[model samples]
Target chain A: MVNRMILANVLHRPIRTAVSVLAVAIEVGMVMLVVGLCHGLVNESAKRVEGVGADILVQPPQSSFLFGLSQAPMPMKVGERLEEIPHVLAVTPVLFVVNSVANLSVIYGVDMTSFDRVSGGFVYHAGGPFQAPYDILVDDVYAKANRVKVGQTLNLLSHEFRVAGIVEHGKGARLFIPLATAEDLQGVQDRASIFFVKCTDPAYGDDAAQAIHKLLPKHSVLPIKDYLSLMTSNNLPGLNYFISAMIAIAVAIGFLVIFLSMYTTITERTREIGILKSLGASKRYIIANILREATLLAAVGILAGYGGSLIARRAILAAFPTLSVELTWDWRFYAASLALIGSLLGAFYPALRAAQLDPVDALAYE
Target chain B: MEPIISTKGLKKIFRIGKVDVPALRGVDLRVQEGEFVAVVGPSGCGKSTLLHVLGGLTSPTEGHVLVDGNDFRGMSDADRTRFRRHKIGFVFQRYNLLPTLTARHNISIATHIQGNGFNPHRFQAVTSMLGITEKLEHRPYALSGGEQQRVAIARAVICEPKILLADEPTGNLDTENSQIVLDMMRELNRTFRQTILMITHNLEAAAVADRIIRMRDGRIISD
Candidate 1:
């Protein structure tokens, strides 16, 4: 019967209940989307780097692990010296340039022969590799997202280029331009931003990386697996703090809305409290009733948020093929726990106040 | 049998702001088991306060009230709540039913609060006795003044508490509904031997009880 009363009470004010549920859902959704996007971008970038088949990565001094974000190029002579390191089978010097046009993209400038020697050559889906200085190759995901064909003309970075081929995704960057054409466009001749080194044996990557560090002490040389680990949210600069701030904002929104809703409900239902007390309801009973109602609302909110985030993730990936959003079970559990704990804390004061109301005064309330 | 309820020099003072205003002053009372007694008085004459104190809804300023052999003065608030759950039932003016619940649920909630769960047998008999078996499916807003009060009465007695305390059960009812509710109470007392302590200002409502105690100035003037 107490359960019946609780259900009846929750359903009594439909508009209020909906607003409370929606508030909590929004909070959960915000937290899920933020975390998903952060982890997704990091993991996807790491996977693409691993796909390049480079056993060791050589970057310029003070450069970010994010290749596209760094524009400072090292001398091409550095690539020649890197190839001389013991156990290094091949070295591919590539220029990383950021193209901020209709979308922010990283255009890889590569010498096709050496790039293929270091990383296995691109798997073409349509046409062949670039044949002219103005020619470009796009990955399949980019092709599908922009509806580009092998013969399509594209204008990027204020320069016109024809799409020579569509290649399979997960090779370093979305758009590929020849090394000479990239240097010509940037006016930085004979310079490369990163060196991708393939070792004779995959197990000898650490030795190759240690040799490169000794050769170029100022540059960052990391084994592929170690570099991938550095790309996670916790290891990335400022990302963990950003995620924490977003989660705090979501929790605050949930807390304030639940608190106000429950407090107003208690005040409006003062007479009802009196009736329950008159029916021999204990203080613990009253507190439990309010808390249980809040818990039910939070539970529904979590389910909605989980479903909403999944749908949103799919829609986002569809709209932007190169983008990824990962919604893992661990984060889902965390979001649910955060929302439940926030809602319970929000309802605590109101529950206590309701329990403390004098039966005589509550009954006399207008 | 000893009186099921006994109050000696019962006093209840309501402090409004700075002044000490007394609602019940040195009132002594007794009601035997299975007796239907009426407490009648004018407005602010402490009859309602007396009912509230007897029902354990409020504490007395200075007095002792023993109901079913349990001394209320020595009992904590939790103890009083437990005692009220098992030993007493209350019917109020204005029907005081949880408007959100159906009549049946509102009536059955008493049994639920007592932690005995629902009693289908007692519920069927009690609703049948009150002539509200058909109206149990409706909410309080859909019921008439008399129907709501009857539902409240059923709720009060569904658990078979030792004493039923009613504060003007018919104060809001029309003539026909008032007579029907009073007759039902009288029938409930005779059939179930239910002990009823009803507080009211209506002489006609008090006429249905076996005895009437009248009060004035917060003290019993006559019995």
Candidate 2:
């Protein structure tokens, strides 16, 4: 009976039903795209951090300055002191500077030997480890995107570095120069922004993080996973505000459409309801009929919305590859929640009108 | 035989500002089991009001309605709905078939609402008996007035209610369609022993009934 009723209602008003479905689909698609982009950003950033494979990352108290804009570099002397602590094993210094890719190359600088110790071995394919002051490695994705070749000299801030080999690291960006070259260009002799520490035993990761925290109370010592999560949450506040605003607007529009559609449906059916009541159909049956129609519309809208999300993901990816958004099934939560809300809100007025109709008055409406 | 439906001094009043207009004024009526009865009157004559009160669709301000000896005045609103669903069937003049459902599904809905599973053979039998078997799969919009009314009749009688209440069951039909509907109602009464109470303004429509009651000015002027 429900199936028959739903089919009937859908068939009766194709234009209205299609419009409702499109509204829901757009909402679902928006939510899917938003969630997918956020997830992608977090995943990519974490891959960069994990590429270093550090048990714990130790940075200067002022190192957070790199989070937003360029700042005075942290002194490299901090890495030396942190390595002297007991059971430290080894510490690799890290330098930070946003190098622009003009013409065709992205340049990053890091200490070649210490970087290898920290990562066990840099996952590289074309170029061997950094051997010269200007030697650097570019990952395959960046190389392909930029159309650059090995042994290429890229100028950055008046310094030229040799791209010794093309390297492929798991989702990490390219290295334009070795650590020494970056320090030389920045003119900071004793300071670097971060230290990547390798514990003698992987099980000692937490202990190492705690020890670093105790050693340098002013600086935050974060485990690899926690650091990645912190980085992911950094942009969450702004994203949350944006999402809340968009969702509120979407909900308002959804309700307005639903209200108008349901109102028209009831108004059109007033005479028919009278006829049913006169035939011995109770108010309960009438209300059920209206609600059943709303539910049917909602279900169709949700399915279309879900499908729209897939289309949205593909479109976004095609338009902006750098957005790096990957679609996932987790987005269904938003679709389901919004769909239920839409159906309930849409059905309320129609149900009330159907239930409260006076058979005599309704029949006289014609 | 005792009355299947009995109403005594049933009064329904509508309030407009400071004045109260009576719709059913001290009405007394009884419908015997298996009887085909019609209450006839002009527009605004309270004939429909009397039918509503008898069918438990509306409450009277000042009287009692006893259905199969059960006092409707004592039943709760939910109980009244339940009683209406189980003991009463309704046929409307405009043939209020849900525009979405096919004729067969329309009738099946009533039985489904009664929480009974679909019985294909029974539905086919009912439609065939009404000579609407060919149009059973057609939606209300696709069927003619007479076909739609037959589907309405099938919907009303599918649950096999103890009493069928109709309001202007043939008022929207032509004379030919009206006669067909009346013939169906007569067959239902004679073959199924179903008690029927109908309201109509047409005297010719009322002529098909076993008994006719007339109303005027919210009161029964003749029976």
Candidate 3:
């Protein structure tokens, strides 16, 4: 009977219930989307970097695991010396520019001869390698997204470049240009952000890295296979804190909305509460009923949030082809739990206040 | 037999800021088991306050109260609430049936609060006797005043409490509905031999009880 009353009370005020549920749904969805985008981008970028077929990577001292964040470029001669290491088959100088034209993207500048040799050559879907210093090579995904053809010109870094080729994606970046042109345009001539060394055998990767590290004592030299696993929010500075703060803000939204909703509902139901007490409802019983309503609302909101997040992920992927939003089950569980806990806490005080109401006064309440 | 209800020096004072306004002034009262009693008074005459004190809804500023062999003074709030659940049932003037629930659920809530499972036999018998069996599926707003009050009466007596407390049970009803409600109370008292204590301002409503006690200025005037 009490359960029926709870359900009836929840349904009695549909608008209030909807507002509360929507607030909770937005909170859960916000947390899931933020966490998903952060993790998805990092994992996607890491996989693309691994696709370069490099066995070893070298960067300037104190450079981050994220290639795009490497601010100080190392001298291009670093690639020449890396090729001398034992078991190193080829070395390529890659100077990347983090550009924001239509969207945020990293355009890698590579020396064609060494890049082709190190990456086993690009599998062209349309045109071939860069034809001129002003030519740009785009991957299939980028070409399809931007609707670019072989001869179409694109403005990158304030310079016009003709599209020379459309290659299969997964070669470190979606867009590429010749190394010399990139260095000249970027004002980093004779310098590269990273040196990608391809080894004769995968097993010689660590040895090549150790040899390179000994030569450039202060620089960062890492075996690519192992470094791929290190590219996570946990390993990245400030990323985890950023994600935590976003989740906290989401939970706070749920808590505040639920608190206000339950408080006002309790106040409005003062007379009804008196009726229940006069019927012999204990404090625990009253509290249980109130919390039960909150939990039911949260449960519905969680399901809505899950569905909304999936739809949003699909829409986002369609609108922004380069952006990856990976919705993990682990984060889904965490978001649901946080919403439930926050909602429970929000309803607690109002339940207590209702339970403490004097039966006589509550009965007399208008 | 010892009285079913006994109160000594029952006094209740409302402290409004610095002024102490007394609602029940040392009024001692007693009623036997299986008896119907009505407390009657005009506005500000402590009849409702006396009913509240006897029902354990509020504590009297000065008093000793014993009902059905349980001492109200020795019981904690939890104990009183439990006692109310099992031993006392209440009906109010406004027929405080939860407006959101169907008439059936409104009555069933009292039985639920007693932590007792639904008894189909008792439910049918109670609702049938009160003539609310056909109205059970309707919410309070759809029910007439007489029907709503009947539902409230059924809710109170469904758990078969030892005592029934009513405050102005017919105060909000039309003359015909008030008469119907009064007849049901009389029937409940006679058929079940239930102990009933009612507070009312209507002399006609008070006349239905076996005994009527009148009060004025917080003291018993006559019986």
DockQ for model 1 equals 0.78
Categorize the docking of model 1: medium
What is the TM-score of chain A, computed separately for every candidate?
Answer: 0.96, 0.83, 0.93
Error of 3 at A136 (Å): 0.8
Best by lDDT: 1
Candidate 1 ranges with C-alpha deviation above 4 Å: none
**Model 3 misplaced regions, further than 4 Å:** A188-190, A235-238
Model 3 residue B28 lDDT score: 86
- Which candidate has the highest DockQ of all? 3
Considering TM-score, which of the candidate structures 2 and 3 is the better prediction for this target?
3
Q: What is the alpha-carbon lDDT of model 1 when measured against the actual structure?
A: 0.91
In candidate 1, which residue pairs clash? none
Candidates arranged by lDDT, highest first: 1, 3, 2
Tell me the interface RMSD of every candidate, in Å. Answer: 0.9, 2.7, 0.8
All models, RMSD in angstroms: 1.9, 3.8, 1.9
Q: Candidate 1 chain A — worst ten consecutive residues by lDDT sum?
A: A63-72
For candidate 3, list the clashing residue pairs, or say none: none
